[model samples]
Target: MQVIATAGHVDHGKSTLVRALTGMEPDRWAEERRRGMTIDLGFAWTTLGAETVAFVDVPGHERFVTNMLAGIGPVPAAMIVVAADEGWMPQSAEHLAALDALGVRHGLLVVTRADLEDPSAATELAQAEIEQTSLGRIEAVAVSAVTGRGLPELRGALARLVAGLPPGQPGPVRLWVDRSFTIKGSGTVVTGTLAAGALRTGDELDLTGVAKPVRVRGLQSLGRSVGEVHAPARVAVNLRGVDKDTITRGAALLTPGRFLLSDLVDVRVHGDPVAGLPATLTLHLGSAAVPVRVRPLGADTARLRLGRALPLRIGDRALLRDPGRHHVAGGVTVLDVVPPGLTRRGAAAARALVLEQLDGVPDVAGELRRRKLIRGSELARTGVDTATFPAPVAGEWLADPAHWAVLQDRLRDEVERHAKENPLEPGAPVEALRHRLGLPDRALVEALVRAPLVTRGGRVSAGGPAVPGDLIRAVETAFEGLGPFAAPEANRLAELGLGPRQLGAAVRAGLVVQLAAGVVLRAGAPEQAVRRLAGLPQPFTLSEARQALDTSRRVAVPLLGLLDSTGVTQRGDDDRRTVVRG
Candidate 1:
């Protein structure tokens, strides 16, 4: 299914075109019907060339620009309706800029009420205005919804546009509802475009902005009940346990943990004609518009504090408006939600937020793959996909491929460093490694260890393939230095710097003893004790062993016992005599 929004100036005949194409009225409110203006969003659908298109008719007046933004927030394509009589108007330009800012790429231009004026003149003017926008090569259709002059051509062009769009892949589901009302028999019904994934009847979803669970009791696509709905489709959902009053525009129905509710987010503002924007305004995301305090975070950056939390993600786009005049200030793509509060004067902190927001972003697959190994809350925080939308895990995030590779490299280095230092120890603790990675969770490390990249035992470390010769030599030198006399500790080995990684390399090459706690033998003392014990017939006392060392009872007694415990010597009947190996 294809979902499209209609945008332009008020009195541009947007509602008229929708009514003509869909055979249904978009304006449902009594006041709006009486005033003949769309104060909020209206929904309708029509079949053009066998393809069904859902229409979101948004208000075009300057006072209701917030309403318009809510309508088009999740639309993948749109119809920029322009009145043929009054070519380009204020709301028309703002609507176009909003679309570009929100990243709506697939759409067409409709010059409406063509019969009331010269079709050629209006078409030329509208085309000229659009040429300056990101809407490159927008197919302009001149139509008289009353005369039906160009309806057939308009239908064909729209069909082609809808057919060319790629189907949304299954991932976390995001539905931005533009219209909500109670059907007499049904409890509550809300309509919007499904941004990603599909929803089925009986499936449980969440109201992100409201923090409530909504059950899908029924579903509709293009005005008819359907078993399932996929991405880019205009859908109406009959919700259980939610009232019409509870759900407002801009509230999103998402798979829980796939998105976060945040009031503070990082945004980049396009240079607009308007200057000296107040530190606060209203922000429209999805179908909800909330008053927000906007403090410029940088030269072209700002931090928005919404009156209430709104459902948003890093890449979601939004439009800002001066609440009083309702004029478009600029557009913003959400960078971080639940950001640390800004005090309107901290320039460095604000700049850092902007830079982090602008940092490298990775593809969805890589992120999901990374999430597979993260913990539940971390997964949710990252807003990675849940099961239905190709989200293979819950409570984790997916890293882009590049990020995942870098993370793997770091893990490998950490493991090698650990193995060298504690030759007696197995590997680094997994929990410690997770903390070092600073990820929301440790599941990614656990998951990656199972791959060809590395092996995880009692701890995690470099695995697979073989060690190099140079590292082997380094390990052998360190191990031989310890000889049969000493067991090394962590900090002491790190000072040498070539311990674990090099030692593991030597062990892998079969050149090092890699002694366990039980296997260590002190060289000079033990050999002398063993020689003295060989001449004795019974187990020698600690004093006897100490006396044999010719130094003190302190060093000799423990040293003899260590050799005995290591199986190189044995205690005799009295425990005071010792027997050495034959």
Candidate 2:
């Protein structure tokens, strides 16, 4: 299905044309029918060729221009109606300006009431006006809803227009609600044009501004209930948790955790000069109309602080209107959703220089270059495809190549400084280095480790101070005279100058193993003890093992505990331990 919105002057037969095409009344209210004017948005649908085309009929009067914008905001295509007798009018120009500001390029020009006068003049005039806007040189059709003249041609043109539209993209859902109401026996029902992504029954959707998520109790398209519906169609979703009053127009149903609700954004203006725009204006995007404060950054770039948070992304298009003047001031293409603060002197000008280079297209490389470091999920939320970018520094944490190189250099410097500051404990704790570099995750520090640097036991080391040659040889000689498990006592260690610092260096260099605070054993002593114990009768008591290795209770106890912790031995409930022979 494809949705098309109607736009024109107040009495230009926009609703009449839709009614004639769909064989249904486009105006729903009895007062509107009685008054022969559309005061609000109306909906109708018809099958054109093999495709179902939904029409969002909007009011053309100046007072309800806001309602017109709401109806046309979410639809992809449009039919700009102009009465043949009236040619072009003020409201026609205003509606055209709105569409142009929105950057809506796909549409058809319909010269309505053709039976009343020669439609050629009106057709030529409307075409000439449209040629100057984004909807350049669209297909034009002259039709009379009264006599049904040229109705078939209009339908064929609409069919071709819908066929030529770009295919709906699959991604996180952002359905802006245009209408919300309660149904008898059913909860709240919100209807809108599903521009992208699919919706399924029972799907949990996040209602913007609502604390809790709402469940999709049911789904309907073109007045028929369905289990699921995809994009480019008009859908009415039955919600379970939210009330009708809570989920009003402008409220959006979003894919939870898939969007970034931003109150401030930097944008590139299309229609009007940024310097001339008012300080405050109404911003229309999707089905939302929000008041915003504009801060001009450049001739065509500015920052907009919205009245409320909206799920915005890069490349999204919207319009700004001067509510006092009752006219669209300009259109905006979102350049940056999570923009940097412009608090410093000349910061706004500098940011404008950067924003001028952005074309409002989501480019992974360009975004990474600008942001330096960002989460993959954040990139996705801002409409960037992380899969197309380079590999991340750590899990989902991307860094620009140049920035990553700088971080690596800084990490090396920090490690070297840490080693010099604390020679006895040369290795820096991973958490300490992470905090020093202001890195968000410890894994990033691990990823930064390179040659001459190693991570072990939660510390990053730059190959700590080497054990002294004399101390190494002396410790080896002292161990050679003792049994495998006969760890040196504190007095013996002191005699060999094997203090805590020396023992720490030796342990890091694999010269000796320190089992406990005061117990030191030769390297490979635990393995040797395990082998000796495996030959014991299945399970041996601690005393038996101590005697077997000819070591005291202190050395034997820590050795057995180390073996057990390393899965080389297991302790039984009987106070006996067995070596794990594998």
The clash count for each model shown is 33, 0
Candidate 1 Cα errors over 4 Å, as ranges: 209-212, 273-276, 338-582
Residue-level lDDT of model 1, residues 398-510, one tens digit each, is 45555567777788777777767655444667887887776655666675464444544446755543455455444444445552334445554455554555555444444
Estimated TM-score for each candidate = 0.64, 0.83
Error of 2 at 445 (Å): 0.5
Q: Provide the lDDT at 124 for model 1.
A: 84
How well is each residue in 1-582 modelled by candidate 2, as lDDT tens digits? Answer: 889999999999998898899998989899999999999889999998788999999999999999999998988888999999999999999999999999888999999888899988899989999999999999999998888889999989999999988777788889999989899999889999999999999999999989999999999999999999998889999999988887778999999878889999999998778898889999999989899999999989999999999999999999999979987998999999999998999998899899989999999888988998898988888988655878878998999888889999999999889877866563888999999999989999999999899887788887644444676787886676787778777888888887887788788768788899978888887778887888889789999998888889988888888888998888999988887754
**What's model 2's overall lDDT?**
0.89
Quote the positional error of residue 444 for candidate 2 in Å.
0.3
The C-alpha local distance difference test score for the whole of candidate 1 amounts to 0.71
Error of 1 at 512 (Å): 34
